[model samples]
Target: MKNALIIALGIITGAIVIGGQSFYHLLTSQNIVNVASGEVRLGEVYDEQLTTTVTIIGDDNETPILTITDATDQIVKDVKQELAQMVVDANKTLSAHEKMRLETAYFDTNVNIELSTEVEYHSQYQKDMQLTIDETELSHHASEQYHFAEAVDMLNTYASKMDTIYHQNDSFIHKT
Candidate 1:
């Protein structure tokens, strides 16, 4: 009877240790995005992963912060790619002089908007953290939520302007 009790306690302790380790790893670990190869396409891939990480971290509030940060970085790169592409496409339609002017305008606009959105995102994140600190001190989830929201809003705003910008480019095309 004594031996059986000892074995049972050992088994329970072992299970707990294993379970704790698995939980710890899940909370702290994340999939790395490898953009160095120049193979990863932007948009859906980053969005899906970000969504999953956000959901996981929000559920447990223990997920790694790097995942969100990396995703945000990638989204910024994607936005830059988009703005660059706009310049490339406009070059095909407008004269060299017109292209220069329009591209410069787009570039300045992109820079301003990107900087402004990032500032707003950080502000929202800090606000969220302050609110959480008054309660549970959990911040990663809040940061992810605000960052994701800001990114989507920024993207949508950029997309909406694309039509108008392209129309202006078309007008220049017809003029020349």
Candidate 2:
């Protein structure tokens, strides 16, 4: 009877361990699915926003500005490619901790992309505003010059912030 009791307990413990492992795997698989879906949605939103912004900016007939836009698009594509690689890496990993780390990384990269887009938009807006100020025959020439200077200052500040973010992101990617 004593031997039987010990054997029963061993069977029960084995079953419990197997069950727990299966449940963990199920959860992790579901998490990957969710992350993949979220990535798709993010990409869709980003593409739409990029198209709209480019359309608005491209309305201007400045060749240099068009070149800048093309460069900006390339930068955005590079960032997105980095993010796609992260997703692929995450999918290949079976470790829960690794997956969580990748998820955090994915979120951080998205934030960086959004910030870069915003900075670009602000810089473009400032430039457009400055151009308008230049073209207009304002009676208050001094005030117009002051506003133009302010716009340039704001653009410079945005450019500086973007540079900082780019460096930080580069270091972060290297660390990971």
Candidate 3:
């Protein structure tokens, strides 16, 4: 009975040590992003045995703070990719003439509207965030529920414009 008890205790301790090591490994990986104030994101990749975190810094209670977590890198990367593609698609939607016009007026207007929508939603919805861009600080004001995800959705709508432009561009040919 004494030997059995010792064996069980050893097994349990070993298991705990292994589990702790696994968790530590996940946390140390740069994939984790922790925020100071707003919503922090975390992801558990069971197959890869990885945990990722992303931190969004924004204003909360009129000051900056940090919210720590393991899940934001993917989201921001995703947003950047989507938005960049959106910019391309938006440009693609114009005929040479229309595209020429957009270069001056419509492009800037649309970008402003989309940026306003995204910034407002992303800033307000996240409580206690340190809002900064390119390391520059941002001030905060109360706004109703401006969902960032929704704003991204709105931005993505611009992609449809690409199809419109393509149809009109005589330079484009569908080889297939």
Best by lDDT: 3
Model 1 lDDT, residue 144, Cα: 33
| Collision count of model 3 | 26
Candidate 1 per-residue lDDT, tens place, 1-176, comes to 99999999999999999999988766433322223353221211111211011111233335521222223235445544544555577678888677643224322211112111111111211221100101112223332333333444554454344334433421112223
True-vs-predicted CA distance for residue 39, candidate 3, Å: 3.3
lDDT of 2 at 89: 69
Query: Which residues of candidate 1, in runs, are more than 4 Å off?
Result: 1-70, 101-103, 107-176
lDDT of model 3 at position 10: 100
RMSD values for the candidates in order, in angstroms, are 21.5, 22.4, 18.1
**How do these models rank on TM-score, best leading?**
2, 1, 3
Clashes of each: 0, 0, 26
Indicate which candidate wins on TM-score: 2
- Count of backbone collisions in candidate 1: 0
lDDT of 2 by residue, 68-158 (tens): 2323234444333444464666557656555533223422110101122322111211221100000111122222322222322333444
- Please report the TM-score between candidate 1 and the true structure: 0.24
